[model samples]
Target: MAAVTDAAGNPWFSWDYVQSNASALLAALIQHVELTAASVLIAAVLAIPLGILAYRVSWLTGPILALSSVLYTIPSLGLFAVLAPFLGLYASTVVIGLVLYALLVIVRNTLTGLNQVPVEIRDAARGMGYGKLGLLTRIELPLSLPSIMTGLRIATVSTVAMVTVGSVVGGYGGFGELILEGFRNNFYKAQIMTATIATVLLALVFDLVLALLGRLATPWSRRRAS
Candidate 1:
């Protein structure tokens, strides 16, 4: 094994060190994904329904969306600070705060998706004796899938980046925790490597997933393979 020393006489990171500790690094990355996915899914489950209801009622959209917007205006750290006393300094506080930040994007996209369902198509579905639920499930949802997928893509990317905020509360370990530890301990390469890998990997994976989803949701939009 090779030994490397830093400017402060502390042990510095090297490729060999990262390779030797691959298992722990992998575990941290998985934990980070779990935390980010859980938070986004919870928020989506809540926001999607709220958006649908807001669209259906016509009168509720203004006030309800405004309220969601107001929530978005609150700083993540400030929100976490307020929630920590009740939730305790834990992953839950960070999850709650991140979810709140995601609400506007999810809800607005949901509303846009639902509204984009053509009125003519909806009326025709109704004329064919489709019930409200049938129209929504069979007609509206499928047609609006592209928009909804767009929302999910946006939310997932945002949430992945924001999960770093979790490290402040001992939420989960991953690249963010690595970066935080590095900076706090003045390990510049650790900070740079972790931050770079996390950011690049997050963006790449999410963008690829979103592209695949877009194709699945809109078959008509897909181009023929040469």
Candidate 2:
């Protein structure tokens, strides 16, 4: 590894390093994004439904929340280590951990959103002859878009940060690989800084994109906000 510092021995950002390692960096970033997106998407699919189930059945709420909380309390590295045995250090090991970690946020937010729907709104919907399904799909979901999307943005950022732990498992770590490799090579400043910057930027970009989508999905909220 080249001195992260230039010939003068001062720590410096190296354009040459970026130029030389562009492909590897790009690959790391892409993997990071893919893993984050996949984990969040899967978590949402599971959590949203579980959240609804919890909402509909008060008796189910305690177990569902407790289970997700327990899964989340397991440390990331420990979770990854336990899963790697069964999943074989593949992306799946890391992804499953991420999904589990994400469930708490998504599920809680989803349930909160649905639960917050005004009683008057439900009564009005019922007066119009809307059934439970119709009320949920038509009234509750649309009103809950903001909360659900907020949970998504939070989960996405958190997942991007945690994905680094996957490095211990293998190439599944994305930019984490860069950070780990840089550390292994005597604290390669350029490599580490580059990876750190890319990771932060990725999280910001995802949050922005999700915010835009949420805004578009809830035009009523947008108008009210304005």
Candidate 3:
């Protein structure tokens, strides 16, 4: 009575299909969230320090950004292909690729935020007897919170999209597997549309969550704007 029913005359969607595949959909969605969150977090952890180092050491900025730029230019499929032999066909390969891809934006944004801190502010902090480490921890970082959060939000959304490409490697692609399955299974209308819709929705939801987190983290930004 289910599976595929053209007799209902609507091929674009199927309530029966969604209801039948609910568990699979939930599993895929969970995997998608895990992949996106892990990649963005790892990227942020690495990028922030690298950004700080580059900002501190004037000579390193070119090389650091250049490397991220190179990583960014590599195609997602190509990056996965490169990592497959080392990481194999697992989530790790996808995660490493995502982390690399996320670096450019996050690192650039971090550096930008640090640079945006006025020179006079640094001098003022120094006048208040704050050392370099203390000044950065107490002043520069807090002021740069908005920019860093913006980069994280952007990286998170992009990572969510890139995660679908991982389906090419394995089940690690989350909802991506559903999309691929739909394509392979004679263009299963409900599966294809459902997975596609879910992907877009997931990205939107992640963006909204990050936006909220960013606002909460940078209450000063709101007050300044007001």
Off by over 4 Å in 3: 1-10
User: Model 2: number of clashes?
Assistant: 0
Count clashing residue pairs in model 3: 0
lDDT of each structure? 0.77, 0.91, 0.91
Q: Write the per-residue lDDT of candidate 2 for residues 177-196, one digit (tens) a residue.
A: 99999989988878888898
In angstroms, the error of model 1 at 53 is 0.4
Find the candidate with the highest TM-score and give its number: 2
RMSD of 3: 2.7
Span of ten consecutive residues with least summed lDDT in model 2: 1-10
Q: Give the per-residue lDDT of model 3 (tens digit) for 66-96.
A: 9999999999898887788877998888899
* Clash pairs detected, candidate 1: none
- Judged by whole-model lDDT over C-alpha atoms, candidate 1 comes out at 0.77
**Model 3 quality (TM-score):** 0.93
Give the poorly placed runs of model 1, Cα more than 4 Å off. Answer: 1-14, 171-173, 220-226
**Between prediction 1 and prediction 2, which has the larger TM-score?**
2
lDDT pick, better of 1 and 2: 2
